[model samples]
Target: MIVPTRSSFSALSCLMGRLFSVYAGYEQQDAHEFLLNFMDKLHEDLNRAPHRKGPPVPLPALVDEAASLNVRINHFWCQHVDRHLSVISDLFEGLLVSSLTCLVCRKSSSSFEVFSCLSLPIPANKGSVCYLQDCLKLFLETESMSGEAAWHCPSCRQKRKAEKRMIIARLPKILVIQFNRFRCETAWQSKKLQTYVQFPISGFDINCFVDREQVETQPRPAYRLYAFLNHYGTLATGHYIAYCRAGHGGQWYMYDDASVTEVTLSESDKRNAYILFYTSVDMRHQFSSHP
Candidate 1:
């Protein structure tokens, strides 16, 4: 029955203030939102290059179409590191490569963006069941961008139909995945999908979801689930609970407000999962010291 000391409790309260200046006064908070805000603030506060003098240095131009994908990825990543260097960036940040290919010219342009979490969309299913890989695949699926969503191809010199696809270009030490369960069905209506998204507790490999051409060559990394946050009830009224691994290769425990209990998650419990936190199996030693 380990409990946080008074100092630790106060530190958590201060961290919450970093996330939100005005507390909701015991009103239920979205766990995902809180996590994101806290992470962002933590990065900002702990940034090594917090204040830069003079105007920001311009990024290197990516005009060379013949350059290899890894070259471009590294160029962008180096530029990013020059401005934002923090443990948060080192551990949690991952790069995504988004390619837009014009259907007419067949010419493609790619852009890289850094992300702290991967928000995956659940594909429409006849039954209320799907796997985590299905959601990841759905997220990485290419979509035809036409009509209003069309892209103006530089090669075609016109608004042409394009195929847009996104793939992971860099892997992070800690991967945070969020399920897009809340849906806006109508202008005034929204609903949460109770789809059972079965995820791997161990040996979770995301290599297939990554752009092998862009990423550096290395042995495949396996991730083990460390923690997951679940939301119960509707969008308006929901309670958040966390299931955290006790330690490296340890039992899972459910953490509710003011109560903690050992838990072997049932299928029903997994259905409520909102955010999943996974750590690289090779990095498991790092988390063994912390509960």
Candidate 2:
């Protein structure tokens, strides 16, 4: 009664095949041909039988909605100084005033400024993929992609849970990460944050999210009172790596726990730099008594 066809048979692979085909033919401009190809893809998707028990990720949307912001810069530190002359301070002012002085370090000696100007042997050309990669890495660190563990606020202090809300104070190259640690505000009540926190700069929670379900309900007795970083989809901009070498040349990320390496910045450290934030997601302050 019915005709068996390839589109109906092995539908998923066929759908995948259409995707590949579309990708390959994307640059080809033929309205009639494109319409036919598009129709084929639509048919494949509609007919593709999916088993929900399989992997969690839905098939890739395959549609390019917008461009990604995975951008970076070579000798970014040098560039940072160039951009934030104020952060570089006297040297930047000197460079602006005196043509001979180095703009970055404000050194009078020709050798120091001259040597400093040479960034990365051959500085990678601007707007290269390397820069984009750096941007992506920074985004990952700051947003939901950040993998650092959580710390708990005092009121809902669990084993290692922190509040969802975050506020920061930034000055030049100095940054204070303010986390809401749970401690007693007064004798009677447990408060969110009485003191402004100055957590060390460290790797961020990439997957920031607020548990809509949990926020409304009581956190599970076992795992109560916690906030999410970012999860799944979140809005973000700019990026950077905030880490230092712990041992060897191997760098380490800063975290709520013992991972962060505390360093006091000096005028020298501030030589050629400005603040760079990797990502900032709209965080959840509080929901309700429940999860």
Candidate 3:
């Protein structure tokens, strides 16, 4: 297997620090934050269409109610890819559809947003143990906008009570989920929630959270956990470690700052899971039952 030498790893780290000044020194950083920044920079550096220099012209709104959901999604995706097409997006990017309905007008509008990672909030009501599905449910629950938070309705011509719902419109080959473990109670105070979140090790189905209207005709996507990062300590000080499978359905290994060890994950270690990485399962049998 090809692996980076110690010198090569150090050189790459230095190069990253040079490119992103915030990572210049040996200061502790958030792994998710670093991952996002690194990916963004790498995407820009490796963008397939480097000649496109100006801001892309926005595509006109889809006004034809007769259009199918899948057609609309494809249109929006094509517009998005026209400007930002890259291998990174092909693998990690997915689209989120946000639907908002004004209570006064009863008119609804939907918008498409792209995401590379999902930062899911851990429900405060959850006790010591929580399930990943529970967090996803909370994230997808319809929210009401009222009072000062009301949305301005174009049809109603005023700020009004609205209902908002978001769902996955596209599924990426690689899915990255981050738990919002670090919370800020105040401007100067924050705490880390150490809730034990149990996630599936294999055959995780995300279709439950997808927009059923759009995917009813498409194949269901399944994911399998291949790696996860864990955090130890409080918000101010912490150490990060990773547990990864060696290969497809392989043994798990723990990677610390400098040491790597093969070990089975215990319940205690599982409690620290902060971020998870899942790859799409592409077996033909995985889709046979969906239709």
lDDT (0 to 1) per candidate = 0.83, 0.26, 0.83
Judge candidate 3 against the unseen true structure and give its global Cα lDDT, from 0 to 1.
Answer: 0.83
lDDT of 1 at 196: 84
TM-score per prediction, in order, is: 0.89, 0.14, 0.89
lDDT of 2 by residue, 1-291 (tens): 123355553574455456766544324232223333554445334432233224333333424322111111112223334323221231111110101222233222111121111011111232212322232233223211112544322333332322222111111111111121234558775532222111112343322222232122222111110111111111122212233323322233332222344544332232212122222211122212213
Q: What order do you get sorting by TM-score, best first?
A: 3, 1, 2
Candidate 3 lDDT at 286 equals: 37
Let me know the TM-score candidate 3 reaches against the reference structure: 0.89
Which candidate, 1 or 2, has the higher lDDT? Answer: 1
Candidate 1 on 119-207: residue-level lDDT in tens?
A: 99998872688899999989989999999999999999999999999978888889999999999999999999988889998999988
Better model by TM-score: candidate 2 vs candidate 3 = 3
Native RMSD of candidate 1 (Å): 3.0
Clashes of each: 0, 34, 0
Q: Which stretches of candidate 2 lie over 4 Å from their true place?
A: 1-129, 132-140, 143-148, 160-291
